[model samples]
Target: MKKKTFWIPIIVFIVTTSVLYLCGHLFNIESLKWFNFEETSNGGFTFGGSLNPIIFGFVIGFIAEWIYKSRNKNRTA
Candidate 1:
């Protein structure tokens, strides 16, 4: 697999998570949380939570790669 292709999901995930976090902070949405699994309370963001964004990014990337390869195989067959 190409290295660039492998990184697409990671980049996308980071961008997505960051945007969500910023939006939550800007809007002061207590329930809006990004990366961390824990929900916001009292209109404040938590420093630590159950979900890890990096791990989630990697998992999403792997799934994307798998699906792309599967489709390629079918197309070639």
Candidate 2:
């Protein structure tokens, strides 16, 4: 795959993560809690979560992009 094709997945990941964080902090929506798992310890804050859909989506996007590039490569050759 060309180097540029690899960026699509990365961009998706960043956008998804940012949206999750924004919704969690800015909107104060409890239903969106699954987006980020937050906690406090020793008077400090911690943040984390499974983000399963993001991971799954990225994996699928990467694979799809890979297959597309391969097919295009063969078509042009």
Candidate 3:
């Protein structure tokens, strides 16, 4: 894969995760609570059931990259 193709998904994943987490926390949405950060006993923090977001973000990232590639390829061809 090209550098942009590889990095696009990663960037999208990061952005998606960050945005979801922030929205979940800031909005105090019950359904999105899983994306919020949880306080641990050790004065540190842990992700609150972030598995869904991780998978969702990755899938969304790949889909976005796929669409982007297809559009660009069509344009060039």
Candidate 4:
């Protein structure tokens, strides 16, 4: 796979996580509040609270990768 193609998934994951984190911290809006019911703080990171972003990152990464691969295949065909 091309380096640019590989980075697409990573970029998508980072952007998704960042957007979720910023929305949670700055706007006090928890898009994934359903997953986080308890409060647990460790150092500068919270488990339940922070896990949402990571989960979202994975989800977004998968979706982005799938889409990217699909488009590439179509273009090549």
In candidate 4, what are the lDDT values of residues 16-61, reduced to their tens digit? 8877777776766666442345444753534355587888799989
Give stretches of model 2 more than 4 Å off: 30-77
Clashes of each: 0, 0, 0, 0
Q: Top lDDT: which candidate number?
A: 3
Can you tell me which runs of candidate 4 are displaced by over 4 Å? 30-49
- 1-77, model 1: which lDDT tens digit per residue? 57756676667677755665666567765444443444477776656432444455557667776777788789889
lDDT of 2 by residue, 1-77 (tens): 45667776676666765676567557776544454555677677666554654665567667767776888899999
lDDT of 4 at 49: 51
Q: What RMSD does model 3 have?
A: 5.3
Model 3 lDDT at residue 22: 73
The prediction achieving the highest TM-score against the true structure is 4
In candidate 2, where is summed lDDT lowest over 10 consecutive residues? 29-38
Tens digit of per-residue lDDT, candidate 3, span 1-77: 48888888899999987788677668887455564566899899866454656677989998989998998899889
TM-score for all predictions?
0.46, 0.43, 0.68, 0.70
The worst-scoring run of ten residues by lDDT in candidate 1 lies at 30-39
Residue pairs that clash (backbone atoms under 3 angstroms), model 3: none
Model 4: how far residue 46 lies from native, Å:
9.8
In model 4, the clashing pairs are none
